[model samples]
Target: MTESSIEANYNRAKLEADKVDLLIAEALENGCSFLVEAGAGSGKTYSLNQAAAWVQENKWAEYRKNAQSAVCITYTNAAVEVIKERLPENSPVLPRTIHAFAWEAIKQYQSFLVKTVTENLDYMPDEGDFARVDEVRYTLGNRYRENGVQYLYHDDVLKLFCELLDNGKFRRMFADRYPLILIDEYQDSYGPIVEKFVEYFIEPGAAPQFGFFGDAWQTIYQSNKACGAISSDWLKVIRKGSNFRSAPRIVRLLNDIRPDLPQTSAIDGFEGEVVVITNDDYSGSRRNDRNFKGELPPDVLRERLDEVTGLIRGNVLPEETTKTLMITHKVLASQQGYDELLAIIGDALRDEEDVFLIFFKDVVEPVYRALCESDHAGLFEALGVKRYPINKKSDKIRWHELRRSLESARNSKAIDVVNAVVGSGLVPIPPKIEGWMSLYRGDSSTLYASSASIGQYLGLDYQQFVAAIEFLQPDASFSTEHGVKGEEYDNVVFAIGRGWNLYQFDVYAPMITGQVPIPSGKQASFERNRNLFYVCCSRPRKRLFFFVSIPLSLEFRSFLHDLAGEENCYTYGDFLREWPERTIAACVKNGAS
Candidate 1:
């Protein structure tokens, strides 16, 4: 193409983007709010950053006159960091997580928080119970207090905010202080609180002209608390149609699944690889007939995952470019070669009382230490082993790799090694760990102590916990659902299967295909899988592959083909033996596109 034509096309695209910007600017200028439904790869962060800069450039005078700041509320601290990094050094945008924003908004109103927690959440008899309460604090867990902290929590803050809503002072504070409120990832926000927030600002003349920026389809993390179909009429809903992250082919697939908010890829000409490998030969009722289903057992599932991974890595996406999103953590521990350890230690992490705290504890401190550098004797005694499992050449090779990589860990930040394990006195023991520890241990005492040490050693930090979780997760790097949210990769191998009691892909397929109507009662189940599937599919910037282990009937196969293009469909045998050559590798010869 001629330089003139190229420049002309670029100008046209820029003009198109500017039109959306103008609309948003006009909305804010006119004291109106909007809901930007950003589709897959639509550059939600870019749009938000642009809006923040635009408001600062255009409305800084008003903000200064009112002695207020433009607030950007995000769901996660990581997101807040992204927003802050995108804005200028002294940018006017005040980006904060919802919790921080909420606390800062009403931290001074301790009496109201105490009243709300005592009467409403704690179910205490009277507000006088908190007469000795020195201060109000917020936590991520259920609301409580030890000393005079009077800690509030996720829901407590909301409850208190709701109670404070009745106070005319709080309402005026909202009207006076925050002149603009831009909420990112609003879909993942708590539904009731979102409704209350929107209702307050959604009115024609509400102050702090607010806008919500998020996609309902990307509402996997908090689907239970998802603000469903948040009435677009009240909220001037706008769809950002440009997908800056994905290739043309990936965007098409995304749009096919999400017909409501179809996106147009911004890339000039990028056709990435897209494939859906299905298996039909796996007959039904294989694992004890219980309502007719066929599932790839842990062993077979591991094999297939490895097979497809190798294929994609060799032919389509590079190993570094590919990311595997494992859906079921239940089998992951076992499949990843740590289920035995997880069995005893997982139970010990926390009793049924406080699950999230233990989850937080698993969040490593300094770095991810995949293997603990325990003394050989402790290792052997922990697992009650007399000899190592280096019988086979392959075992010897892996054992050597483990030794070399054992020195490697997650991050570099030094943390005080609290509760440091001197020996294998923390790790839980099963036959696998027992055998593993046996290699290092001299006798049974060390083998049993290994189990004792498992919990504290792994709880070193999130990095360590993640390392331990996916330790050998099949000799391949894997990403957890929570860990990989909002992250992008060149290619994604999303494993979908009949695992996790929470999801029902077997039933979801029929409902989606129109063969079996999903009852209203089961809507949540359908949404749970649907949102997760969408989130996974949209993660890959270049290529997307699905490793479905559950039964895929003819209808489901057709549905998948329709969603991912028939040219992209492949049978298990075809992918294994004669998988079609990728056009992406053939055409794009240079760097990472």
Candidate 2:
């Protein structure tokens, strides 16, 4: 807190900021490609935006003279929005998702693509092919017309663009158009086509300067084995090791967990507590407990809930000043388990808004949007209000009425609302909504009936969906590990060993303890488990409580003890015996003070 100490801290922060600027300047100046391995909580996005700004400020004259713009490619549309918001208006930096960027390229070079495709194909397109293309165009809401070839799906556009990029003329044209190509979350970019695109465009001594920003250790996408293959002798590799999100204790724990990806804490000597609680008395055998047997036994589940409840009550203030999160690896593995956790948290935090529900209601959201598209009279009829519209001319008033009705029915069952709307004949049901309902009601024996298939059926990754909806308010204090990434809390209770198909806790637990070597074939799985654990454990800014359902081997217990300290590592039985009294004493002391 001294003046000199404050100045030193300020200087340290400034240097960290400058490091990114220096990397960007070096890559831009030399026209050499680079990859920045920005770890979790590293300001990757901010650095990307700064790089964009640098290009605009320093190279704008050269770019403008050639009618070119600096292009930033993000992993998600949400990321694109963030980058767009951060950049100044008319900054000449084109920020877009990969798909959006591809679509734009298709639009810009439609004529060239048509010519190439026609020349490459053995047979000319017939009316049926054009009919299918028309369907695609309608589906994508693309209305542009060029040489009567006005139809293309997203994949088709990407394929055509890739083909065009292979042509030397088009490749040079693209490089001229985009002199600086920056890809965010590059590790998640996979697929043979994507690999070809990256290789073709980002070749050594290419006209455009390409920079990739990502963490290979955090490449949790199982299908992306090519992520690590992106590195080359010519590519400049920069490592951003300072973690600005977590406390020093959490950073140290992350380093211990994944020594391959060692990170340093930005804040010096920052303190936090890490508690590892295991259910050593669980009845399941190691062989049978790989997936935690899908659900915990009744008593064990109660004990786990009790530990979570006690932690929240003891460490979490009633005033809700400090944020708290309870993360589980499985959010929808067992509906019964999910409901029980919600019930327990609701009862414990009665009338408190701290326990927010995070879920992907994508299956329901589009239906709701469709229902809301109806006019006021139709919506009222659907809701059984039997009210006539007072102002027929104003669509805005009708929209407000529809919004209020939909808002009030937010918690209603999707089936009931859909039935009401369809039965009332308010509006024609969209085909997409009907298709979704069909999948939801599909045969239990079908692939879509399985819990693992729901996400794919709904056109989303389940973990990503859970992460996207963390802000929605609901009557629960539960979230998936993926959902809590990059988010901090004062208190965190993470439930591991849940039956998530992707995470093999049996394999991971042993790997963590050094009991077994991570199989070369399953290295991706190992890295994913490590990354998820790191993300969950590092979320707590002050206190972390980990509850593992399966019985832990002695080696695993020792591993937990080493990371959390023996004083903080406790068996479920030990915690139950000691924590209640400690909780009571703390509450009494706080009251007395």
Please report the candidate that would top lDDT against the real structure: 1
Q: Which digits, one per residue and each the tens of the lDDT, describe model 2 over residues 1-593?
A: 76666345334644775776697778778888888888776667777877888887888788778788888887777878888888778777889877678767656664565565455442234333342121123135343434455455445565665666677887777777888888888877645544665577555556677888877666655643435437567678877766666666777777777676566565543355577778776566343455456456645565566555555565445643233333332333232233332332332222222212211233234434545675544445443446553446564555455455545544443344454444444335557556655666674233433242432333332233233233243433555566565567656677766566677554575586466688889876776786666667767655577777665666666667788898877777787676656555544444343
Residues 269-307, model 1: lDDT tens digits: 446667788765555334433422466766766777777
Scored by Cα lDDT, where does model 2 land?
0.59
The alpha-carbon lDDT assigned to residue 501 of candidate 2 equals 68
List where candidate 2 sits over 4 angstroms from the true fold. Answer: 1-14, 111-150, 191-194, 201-203, 223-229, 268-270, 282-290, 318-476, 509-515, 576-593
Q: Which candidate is the best by TM-score?
A: 1
Please give the lDDT score at residue 92 for candidate 2: 75
What are the models' TM-scores? 0.75, 0.69
Candidates in order: C-alpha RMSD to true structure: 9.2, 9.2
